[model samples]
Target: MIITKSREEIELMRESALVVSRTLGMLASEIKPGVTTLQLDKLAEEYIREQGAIPGFLGLYDFPNTLCMSPNAQVVHGIPNSTPLQEGDIISIDCGAIKEGFYGDHAYTFPIGEISEETSKLLKVTKESLYVGIEQLRVGNRVGDVGYAIQKYCEDHGYGVVRELVGHGLGKTMHEDPEMPNYGQRGRGKKFVEGMVVAIEPMINQGTKRIKQLKDGWTILTADNKPSAHFEHDVAIIDGKPELLSTFKYIYDALGVTSTEEDKFRSKAYD
Candidate 1:
């Protein structure tokens, strides 16, 4: 069943989401060539605890690290290691936090320094698809509506949408009901209702949609060994519209980048 959140509970979730947003922002400056994923993971754990929130991904599902540090061809769930990131490399950092008894989860793909033109375009399109999917999370829209929006947006750009791993409803527990796929037909899944909150993420591959798993039983990779980009956001339905509980403003601020992409989804000024 889809568990909904009250207005008060939604505010609590917003707090949890901001915890993660701030954590990502703090890591933005640290992500550079020669930095190991494990080092970044350690920093995230300490920072989350300093915020009085537990690392949501740590010890959950026996996962060993605070972040799912997937780089280059790795899609998601890539375990953090001692491998130092190189210039032109892109890493997807999926993070989570638990605060006020609620969970906040999201991911962002970052370029180590400078990346190829092709890889840059992949990241740009995948992130754009995330907002396109978010726009479909409305009062009367179905789950498939969101998926179709994401899938169509990426596919039109000749990108492959991953099928196995998907976005999910977020609340007390990490994962919840109503699996949010990136590919589906409109009006074919559960109907979205008010007070519902979910993590809508798009995992788009630069090659075929097929994927493979690593021997570690955690990492997922593209079948063709091509790069994949993942972007996510925590959203809730309020007043019959989708409201962003998480903001990229912190990350943008840290990077000295500016964009109004999230303005339309926000109800008020993001502070």
Candidate 2:
């Protein structure tokens, strides 16, 4: 069943979501060549604890890390390791936090040093597809609407939309009802209602949509071994519209990048 959060519950969720947003922002400056994903994971664990929130990913599924650090061809669920990131490589950091009986989950893909123009375009299109999906998360819309928007946006650019991994509803648990896929037909699936909150993520591959899992039983990668990008956001329906509970502004601030892309989804107080 789809769980609808009360307004107060949504506010509590926003707080938890910001904790993760801030954690990603702090790591944004530390993501550079020679830095290991394991090191970044340690930093995230400490930071999340300092915020008075527990690391949502750690110990949840017998996972040993605080963050899901997938790099280059790895799609998602990549375990953090001692391997140092190199120039032109991109890493997707998916994080979660538990606070006040609620959970917040979000993710962002970062580039190490400078990347190829082709990879840069891939990142751009993937992120754009994320917002396109978010725009479909409104009252009376269905889960497939969001998926269709994301798939159409990325496929038109010749990118492959991952079929296996899908986004999910977020609340007290990391994963909840309403599986939000990246590819589907419009007007299908469960209908979205007011007070519903979910994590809408798009995992787009640069090659074929097929994927494979490594021996670790955690890491997922593109079957063709090509690069992929993942972006996510926590959103809630309020007043019959989608409101962002998580913001990438903190990450953008640390990287010295300015954007008003989120302005349309936020309230005046959030600006």
Question: What is the C-alpha local distance difference test score of each model?
Answer: 0.95, 0.95
Model 2: residues with Cα > 4 Å off, grouped in runs: 268-271
Flag regions of model 1 displaced more than 4 Å: none
Cα lDDT tens digits, model 2, 8-102, are: 99999999999999999999999999999999999999999999999999998899889999999999999999999999999999999999989
lDDT of 1 at 144: 96
Residue 170's lDDT within candidate 1 is: 94
Whole-model lDDT, candidate 1?
A: 0.95
TM-score, each model? 0.99, 0.99
